[model samples]
Target: MMADNLMQSPENWTESQVSTWLRTLCVKEQYIKKLFEEEVNGLVLLTLDEDSLMTKIGMKFGPTHMIIQKRNELFNSKQNSQQNAKPTRSKKTKLQQKNNSKSLHCLASSEVPSGQVHARDKCASEESQTPQQPCILTSKENCKPRPFDQEGIDLIYVKHRVLQPESGAFDLISPCHEFKSFAIAAELDRTRLQAKFAKEVLKFATGCMNIRSNGTIHFGVMDSKEDTGYVHGEVVGIPVKDKDIYVDALDDIEKCFSTDKEHARHCVRPPRFIEVMDRESTAKNYVVEVDIVPSVYILKGKVHAVLLPNFNEAANKVQYEKKAILRRVGSKTEPVSDSDLSDFFQRVKERDAQREEAEKTLVLSTPFCQDLGRKLTMLITSGKKFIENDKWFIFITNKFKPDDLSNIEWLLNMKILSVFDFDPDSKISGLCSKYLEHHAANMHSLQSYSKSSDRSIKGFTEKLHLFEQTSWLFCNGRSGFKANETPCDEMTWIKTRMTLLMVYVSLICKHILPKGSLQVIFLLTSPVEKPLLHTFYGFFTEMQGHTDIICICESETNFQRWQSFAEEICGTETVNNFSVVGMKMSHINATMQMIQPVKACAKKHLPVFVKGTCLLETNREEHMASLEILTVAKKHLPVFVKGTCLLETNREEHMASLEILTVNHCDDTSKDFINEEKANIEQQFYRGGRVTWMNFWLAEHKYVGEVIERDAYQDVSKLLMDVLKFPL
Candidate 1:
C-alpha cells in the first residue's frame, strides 16, 4: 500500500547518490556506474521493479530484495520533498516526467479504487513531514530500527536476515582453506536445499579406511577445475528456501555417513556434516559439506558411482560412464591406467626376489667364517686348479649344520668350493669329521710353531705324528711300526718299512717346499701293494703335484701295472725307468730332488718306435757304462747341426771344430790313410752320407773303441743308404 502512494523522479539524482543507493541494494560496484550513466542518457530506466531488475541487470536474489526496499524509500522521500517545493527540471527530464506520470495514472485507475487512492494519499501527506521507518520485521520479531533520513525516508538496514550466511557464521565449521577428508554435496534439492543425494554421495566417499591422506570433495560452488585436488569439484551456490532447509541438508548428509558400514571400521573419529555458505555470493544458499575421518590404509576396491560427482554420468560430462576410480596423482585426482597397475605389480615382484636373495646370503659372523669366506672368494677368482684341490676340502665343513648346505649351493655353483652333498648321514660324514679334526690339528700346530718362532720340533715326533694322522686309513695293521710282542711277519715288516719311508719323505720336504711341489717315488714290489699305492696316489693327486711321479719296480709286470695306474690317475703317458733290480731296494736311500739339477747321461725320449718307446738308459751311471751308439736319421738332427754338417766338404779342421762328433759311412772298405795338407788336400778320399765312423774313428783312441762298436758303423752305413732312396 505504501509503494502505491509513494512517487519519485530520479532524473535529478546525482551519479554519486545513485551509486550509494545501488551499493546498499548490493548491486556490484562496477555495474552501478555503468547503469547510472545509461539511466541518465535515457537508454535505461530506474522505474523497473525488483523482478525486472534481476532479469535485466543479472542481480542475485539478495540484491534484488534490497533493491525493492530502496526503491519504495526513494518514492516516499520524493513525496515529502514534493509538498515542500518542486524542483525545476530540464526539457528532456520534463518530457520524461510527463510520460512516467501518465503511465502511473493509467496503472492506478485500472488496478485500484478511487477511494483507496485518496485515503493512501491522505495518509502519505500526514506522515510526509515525520519520516517513517521502513518495517522489515517478520511476524515473529521486529528488527532493530535506524533513524529516518532528513527527507522523511526510513533508513532500513539493507543487509538483513541472511538465510545462509558465510561459513564463518557457524562456530564449529572447519576453515575454508583447510583440508578435511570427507564427501560433501552442496544441494540435495537445490530449490528445497535438501540433501537428496546424501545417501548416494556417502557411498562413494573415500571411507575412513580408504581415505589414506588428507583431502576433500565439495559440491555447490561453481565447479572449478582450477581448485587443486584440495576441494575436488566446485559449488557455485545451492539455493535454499530458508535456514531450516540448510539444517535438514546437514542432517541428511551426516546421517548417511553415520549409517555407512565401512565408516565405523575405517573412521578414527565421527564424521562431521556442516552447512557452509558461499561467501563469494550473497544468496540464501549453502554447501552441505561432510568431513569423514581418514584411514591409514587405502581401500582396494571399487567405489559407487553415485558418490563420485565425476562418475555421475547422468549429471557429469566425464569420460568414464557409470563408474570412475579416481586416485590422487600428485596434486590432481586422475584415473589409474592398466599399464601403471602392471608396473606396480612388477616392482612388487622384483622387491620380493631381492628380499629372498638377501635372506640366502652367507653370514660371516665368526672370525674363522669371515676368513674362510675371503679365501673362498680369492680362490674362485684365481683359476680352476685351486678350486679343484679344495673341492674335497669339504672335509672342513663337518662343523656346518645341515641347514647351512642350503645356502652353500650358491657358493658351490660359483666354483668357490667343490663338494659332493650326497647323503648327510653316510659313512663319509665320519670321514669328513676326521678330516676336519686333522685339518684343525695341523693348522693349530703350524700356528703354534709360528708363534713360538721355533724350528726345533723333533723329527721323530713329527714322523710319529704323521703316522698316527694316517693310521685311521688302515683296518688293523700298524703298517710301518714295529713292536717286540708282534715280532715281524715278513709282509707286515715290508709294509711298515714302506709306510715309514713315505712319511719320512713327506716330513723332510715339508720345510723346503709346499707338499704339492714335491715329486714322490714309491717302490713297487708285490701285487698286494697296489691298494696301498692307490691310497698314496689319491693323497698326492689331491695335493696337486708339480713334477713327474716315479716308481721303482722289481719286475716288468709290476712296472707295467704301475704305469697303467699312473696313466689312469694322473692323465699322462710319459714314463722312464732303470733296469729291474732284484736286490733289496730298501737299501737305497729314499732321496727327493729336482731332476733338472742332476746331469750325467744323454738319453732322448724320442718317437723312434711306431707307437711308444722309453728313453733308454735314463740312469746316469747305467748310460755312461753302456756302449755309445751314434745313430742318425734323415731330419733327425737339429737345423743348426744339420747346417754345420752339410758344409763339411773339407772336414779336416771343421769336423774337429764341431763340439759334437760325427761318423762317415765307408762303402769302399778302403785300407788307405789320408794325411791332408793345404797344398794337397784330398777331400774325396773319405766320401759318404753324414754318419759317425764308429769303428774307424775308434782306432784313433784306445778307450773310445771300447764304447763304440764296429756293428754301429755298419748300421749307420745302411741307414744312410735307405735315406738316399728318396730322390733329392
Candidate 2:
C-alpha cells in the first residue's frame, strides 16, 4: 500500500505521512516526525542512502538507520501484494524453471567443489558490497581450483559462470557480465597465468577508479524511488579453490607494477583479494574476490583487455590496452589531445603573469597647481639637470617653433632640445639638409644673444648634427594627407599613416636617441579632433619608458575631450594630467609632478626597445618617381604617412562604428586579442605570436594598460557581404 501510494503521488508526500509510513518498521512516530521536520524532506527521503540521511540531511542516527529498513518493508509488501494478485504459473513455465535448476546443479556438481560455492558468494559480497547469488560453473576433467597463497602460481583451469535464478536451472548468464564485479576465465596457460591475471586485475581496477558522480560509468548502482526503482547488479561469483588464489593474484599484480618502468608512478595502492564461501553447496570449490582501493589522486595508465559496463550500451564491451588520459568532453571521459594541453598551459601562464603584475607599484600623474608651478620652474631653472655622459635625450614640439625656444633659458642649457620642428613624413635625408639650415640659424641666434666668439660656434655645431638627426625636423601629419590621394578608403589610409608614425618613432628612439636615455617628449597641438588618433594614443601607451606626451589643446572642450580619450586609451580612470587652454598653472605643475617620477625611475631601469624596421618590398613606382622630385626639392623624408579621421562625433556613434575601441585595464588581453584578431589583426598592437613577450612585459608596465577594441560582428558581416557581392 505504501509503495502504491508513493507511486501515485511521490511529490505530494508530507512530513505526517512519512512518520506514519515509517512507524510500523519499529521507527518511533515522534522521532520520525521530528527528524522528518528537521533534516528529512518527505519527497527525497526515499532517494537518500542511510549514511547520506544522517550526514547530509542532518538526520538522527537511530531514525536514519531505520530508513532503509522501512523502505525494504514497503518494497517487500509491494512484492507480496503483487504475488497474491497474480495467477499460478502454467505447466510449461514450471517445467522451464525445473530444467534451469537441474542444469545449474549438474554444472555445479561437475565443476565447483562444495566449499568453492561458499567462497564465490563471500567474494561477491566482499568486493561489490551487495547481496550474493548462486552461480554454476561447468568444469572439465582438467579444471581445478587454485589456492590464493600457492607460492609458485600454477595453471588454474576455470569456466564461465552462470547465475541460478529462483526455481530455475542456470539458464541466465550473469546480468551484463561485462559490468559485473567478478570476471571468469576458462582454460589456463601454466607458465603465463600470473602475468595474465595481473593484466586483467588492473583493467577492472581502472574502471572502478574512473567512476565519477556525474560521469557515464554508471554500473554499480542507481538510486530509484517507488516511481523509479534503483538500478543495481547482482554480485558476480568467481570459482577458485581457496582464498590463497587472491594472495598469488595480488602478488603478481604488485610485481607487474614494480617491474613496469613507464607507469609505475600512477599506481595508487596494492589490491587485496578476499575469500568467500557458499554455505548451502556441499563442494570444496571457493570464490576469490579482487577489491581495488580508492586514493587521493586519480590513477591513470594503460591497461590490457577489460570489460566495463556502460549505461548507454546494451552490455559491457571489451576495451583494448590504450593510454588512459580521461578528460571531460561534454559529459563523457574522452582522451585528451595536444590542443587541450596547450590551452591549459596558456591559461596557467596568464594567471601567473596577472598575479605578478598585481604586486608592482603604479605612479599616476595627478593634476595640481603646486606640482604645475614646480614643473614650470624646473623647466626654466633646472636646464642642465638631465645631463649624463652615458645617456642621450631629445625633445620635439608641434606647438612651439624655433623662435619661441630662443627666449627660453633652458634651451641654451640642454643640447638635445633643439627648438626645430620636424615632420614625421620627412625622410632622414631631408633632416640631413635641415641640419645645415638649423646650424646656421642657431649660430646667428646665439651670436646676437651673447655677442660671443666663433670658437664656441664649433662646439655647438659639433653636437648640432646629433641634435638635427635626433630632433623633430618635421613630423607633420598634414604632409601624410597630401601624399595619399585616396579619400574613399580613409581608414585604410589612416592606418598607413599611423603605421608610418609608429615606425618612424620606433626608429628614432632606437637609432637616434642615446641608449639608456633619461627622457623623450612629443608635443601635439589640437590632437583630439583628428580621426584615428588612437594611433598616437596607442603608441604612447605601448612606449611606456620615460616618454611624455604634451597635448596643447585649442580650447577647454578639446582639452577635456582629449583627457577623456587619454583615460580610455591608457586604460585607466586617472591618467597623466594635460594642460588646458586657461589652466597653465595646473598643467605645468602636473607635468612637473609626472617628470619627478620619470627621473627617479630612469636611474633604476632602462627602456624596453626593439630594433629597426626593414622596409617592405612592394610596387613603389609612384614613390620612386616622386623621390627624385622630393630630393630635388630638399624634402625627402624617412617614411610616408597618410592621416585620416573617423567622420563621427557622438560617443555612441563612435562605439557603433567599426572603429577600434578602448578596453578597461581589467579586461583580459587574451580574450581581447581573440576578438580583435578575428575582426582586424592590424588594428591590435598585441598580435599574439608576433609579439608575445614584448606585449607581456609592456602590459605589465604600470603606465601601459590600454588595448584596442575588436571589430564589430555587424561590420564583419557587412564586409563579407560586400566581398560576396563584388567577387573577383
Q: After superposition, how far is residue 14 of candidate 2 from its true place, in Å?
A: 62
lDDT of each: 0.34, 0.35
Best by TM-score: 2
Q: Specify the poorest-scoring 10-residue window by lDDT in model 1.
A: 587-596
* Residue 459's lDDT in candidate 1: 55
How many Å off is the CA of 200 in candidate 1? 10
* lDDT leader: 2
TM-score of each: 0.20, 0.22
Count steric clashes of candidate 2: 51
lDDT of 2: 0.35
In angstroms, what RMSD does candidate 2 have relative to the true structure? 34.2
- Give the per-residue lDDT digits (tens) of candidate 1, residues 101-204: 32121112222345435544554554365454334322111121111111221111111111111121111112111121122223223422243333323332
